[model samples]
Target: MKLLLRLATSLLLWIIMMVILVLIILLPRDMEVKRIGVKDHMSYHFTWSGYKENIQQYLADVKENKTLGTSVAHQPVEWELAHYGKRSIAILVPALIISFLIGILKGVFDYRRNRGLWKVLGEGTTWLGQSIPDFFIIIILELIISLTIHRMFPHLQLYGIEHWYNIFLPILFLSMYPAAVIANYTTQALKEEDDQDYIRTARAKGLPETIILWKHVLRNCWSKILIHFMPIILTLLSSMVIVEYMTLYRGMGTRLMEAIKIKDTIASTDTILPIETPTVIGFSLEFMIILLLAQWVNQVIKHFLIPVRKDEHT
Candidate 1:
């Protein structure tokens, strides 16, 4: 019931945000372009009729499968949605899975080893990874791969998602920061769990360190780990814009940029009204759903991990 309420609230919030975004986009802007035999002409107005007309036209285009007639491209909004939706999923799913696994494994290793070169390298790498901006990482990695590896293997293109291998670099770029964040939190959570009385009791019982850490400590630390997951997801979502743009992946982020650039133009001049509304709404929905899912997952994990106490009845 609570989850349902939360979901409803999130959906409502997303709708509100989308409405505001659309209004901002639809609001007229003062044009400063020089017209022959005319002084500066500033025209800016907000009208309900315009907003309604725009919405109706967008819906009509979608229903009739009509091309949006964008200044740069003549493609139906449906095609754009389907194409970018698939690419976004392709990038998001694999990057998330790989990052989560790497983070958990790195966290476990960091907790187990007291002193070693592996620890030194892992700590240094994660710290560096967390500190650097994702775009810089993407640029540096692209340069290194293009110069050295691509010379030996010309099949791998530096930009554009032409093949399956093309996604590798972008995914790596997206995953690095989140993975490092997760690993850092995981290590801290486990270290804190290590000093708890339950851990001490397990150690005193002569249980193997591996079993105790994995079966007991790690199980207890899941709730704590999940608490930090939402921020990691938000980070990944934001980073996708840069990564997709840099790699020319033709995803939602790229579409969003195009939409923003042409938001103020007239439909006759640039017919992106249909494309802009759906793109903005689609991205907003995706973001809200992911956020809600993260919250739900965290709540489920926390509920399961928490101890349920029985009340004594006289």
Candidate 2:
């Protein structure tokens, strides 16, 4: 019941947010900014008497199957959004899954054997990962590839994402810092769970360390870790955007970069032209949907975790 309530609350919030986003995007810019070329067709913004009219027109567009309107590039916003969104997900989902697995295991290993060289390495790696900007990490990877791997392979293409595996590098770079955060959070949660009287009793019974760690310690710590899942996913989204833009991965980030580019006729002019309001809004709406999907997935995971927790003793 509580979980359902949380889902309901989140759904309500998402709807409110999307509505506000649409208003902001469709809101009129200064009439002074010159609308040119394909932009002349963007008559919706050039003339807006009131929000009610705009909302009604938007609904009409929906009914007429012109939902996404158009883009500055003179292409359908819906088609472009789907293309880039697909690219973004192709890289993002794999990276996120890899990071989660690596992070959880590393965190467990770090805390369970918290002594000597292994401890120092795990702590240092996580700290450095959080400290370093993802851009530099990608740059360093690029430099290494050019310096060594490309030279060694002679004709092999490592960048520009020609094949599915071409994005392997981007995925690795994207996974790094989010994994570090998860490791740190997991380690802390485990630490707190470790000190509990229940853990102490379990240890007192001469239970195998492996069993105590997995069956007892982790079962309790999971709820704490689950609480951080959304934040970690947010981190992944931000980093993936940066990585995609830098690497020119032809993903949503690249599309976003293109959408935001200033199309001003005079570079010195203070007037800010609308790059593609519909495109921008389309991009934003899709991104919001991704987050909504992530939230739903997290709730589902929690539902599954509940059963696992109950069955732990069995």
Candidate 3:
């Protein structure tokens, strides 16, 4: 019931945020006109009706099996969607999997072993990973890999989806921050759990350290680690913009740049472009959906944690 309420509240907030963003994007702009007598006349006006009309038209186009709209490059929205979906899946899935595994392992290790060179190395690596900007990492990796590896295999593509290997750099760059954050949070949560009476009792029973660490400490800390890592979705999204743009991956971020360029061009020319509305709204919807999904995942993990923690106490 609590999970349901939280989900409901999150959905409501997401909707409200979307509505606000749409309103801001649809706000009026100043325009200049020339008349017979007046050399130059300036007017500022809202085009609510036009915005509504464009949305209706776009929906009708979809029903009739037409394009969503044209992008700045004159490509249909359908094309952009296909490419964006592909890149998003390719980058996000592998990154998430790798980050979660690495984080969990490092965290568990850090929790069980207090004094070691490995612990110091792990801590230092995560701190450095969290501190460095993703874009800089992407660039450095590209340069080093291209110079060394590309020379041996000139056929490998760095930026496009022509081959599966193209995604490696972006995924590696995107996963670093989240993995570091997860490891840090997991270690902290486990450290806090270390002083609890239950942990003390578990220790008193002379259980194997490995078993106690995994079955007791980690089980309790998992949900909190997930909660702390939820915001990594936003980080991934932001990183995608730079990663995709720099790599020319033709993903949603690249499409967004195209849309932004189109909007800017139209504004400068005093031309009201209907295509910009759908383009902007489409990206906004994608972001909101991702955020809601992250929240739902967090809530689900939290709900499961309640039962597990209760069992531990019992």
| Predicted structure with the largest TM-score when compared to the true one | 2
Encode model 3's per-residue lDDT on 123-169: one tens digit a residue: 77777777988777777888998898889889767777677677887
Global CA lDDT computed for model 1: 0.70
Query: lDDT tens string, model 2, 95-171?
Result: 88888888888889878767888878887787787789878887888898889988999887756668767788778
Which pairs of residues clash in candidate 2, taking residues 3 or more apart in a chain or in different chains? none
Ranking by lDDT: 2, 3, 1
Instruction: Give the better candidate number (2 or 3) by TM-score.
Output: 2
Q: Model 3: which residue pairs collide?
A: none
Off by over 4 Å in 1: 30-32, 35-72, 114-119, 262-314
93: Cα error in model 2, Å: 1.0
Evaluated at residue 186, the lDDT of candidate 2 is 83
Displacement of residue 185 (Cα, Å) in model 3 is 0.8
Per-residue lDDT of model 1, residues 127-183, tens digit only: 787898878888888888888988997876757877777777778888888888888
lDDT of 1 at 80: 67
**Structural similarity to truth (TM-score) of each candidate:** 0.79, 0.83, 0.81
Kindly report the root-mean-square deviation of model 2 from the true structure over all alpha carbons: 5.2
Which has the better TM-score: candidate 1, or candidate 2?
A: 2
How many steric clashes between backbone atoms does each model show?
A: 0, 0, 0
State how far residue 312 of model 2 sits from its true place (Å): 9.1
Measured by lDDT, the strongest candidate is 2
